[model samples]
Target: MASFAVLLRAVNIGPGLRVSSADLRGAADDAGLADARTLLNSGNLVVTPGSSGAGSAADVARLVEERLAERVGQDVSAVGLSAEQLDAIAAANPFPAAARDDPSHLQVHVPFGDLDEAGIARLDLASPGREMLATAAGVLYVHYVDGIGRSKLTPKVIDRAVGAPTTARNWNTITKLRAACAGLASR
Candidate 1:
């Protein structure tokens, strides 16, 4: 079975679904994903596909949604990315200096599906405030010099701009996920 990184959207935020990482791990294990592991609380999970014919991103997303909704008592949707995909995203980061110097300042909003160009063009890239870098891999690398809270480029804004369901994670989380993927690959 191949290793997959599953990113759940709109979970553990505000007053929404509050499933803990530990509980999520149990839920994933119960859902038949081998050696399920979670990082932090933003719903980043690394799992091995357990079924005989299951490794696709769409398959993993369906499995997570089905099991997590039953186990956590709420609708939880996810997007699956392979270990190599995660590593490629890390390597394609446009603002490496910003990520290295100020990880908190550099953030990424990744779509669970293909991003349409017409939707992405809605973003005002020429705006004087924040900077957004789009890669061919469909990940947006953003840097807000004044911090995320102070910037207008929210997750909602990105979702609107890209017109795709997405989840946001900081540079630190991205790097850690890459490392986690590497660790899983070695196993």
Candidate 2:
């Protein structure tokens, strides 16, 4: 079976939609994914299923939405990734030096799509402490020297940029996810 890293979006950020890691693992297990492991509270899951090579990402996303709705009482959005995809995410880290040790720098992973120049320019991200729009391999890498919570480029900007949906993780979380994918591949 191939290794898969599922990045769940818009989960338990505040007090309202709280989903514990153990509960997330249980949901994955119930969905028939094997050896499911959760990385952190922000909904990063690494699972090895019996037929990981079988299903499409849309299928996985559907399964997660259905199960999480039942288990956590909320429909969660998930993005699935193979080992290779996760490796590419690691390699595609634009601000690698800043990402290594800085707590504020983050990587926003968006799917491959054609974002129009007009739409891209409409993003009013003139913040001083943050560097926006580092496009590499179809992924937008946003590095925030200041904390994301304080940044002006909120989730609304991201949603408009991809024109679909996007999820982000801090530099440390991205690094850990990459390492977990690598370890799973080695095994």
TM-scores, one per candidate: 0.90, 0.83
Per-residue lDDT tens digits for candidate 1, residues 49-113, read: 87524567567667877888888888887888888888788878878789889998787888866
Q: Which one is best on TM-score? A: 1
**Tens digits of lDDT, candidate 2, 70-182:** 99777777877777766776687767777666745676655524544445545535444445567655556777766677876777766676576777777687667767867
TM-score result, candidate 1: 0.90
The deviation in Å at residue 76 for candidate 2 is: 1.2
Candidate 1 weakest ten by summed lDDT: 125-134
Per model, how many backbone clashes are there?
A: 0, 0
Estimate every model's Cα lDDT from 0 to 1. Answer: 0.78, 0.69
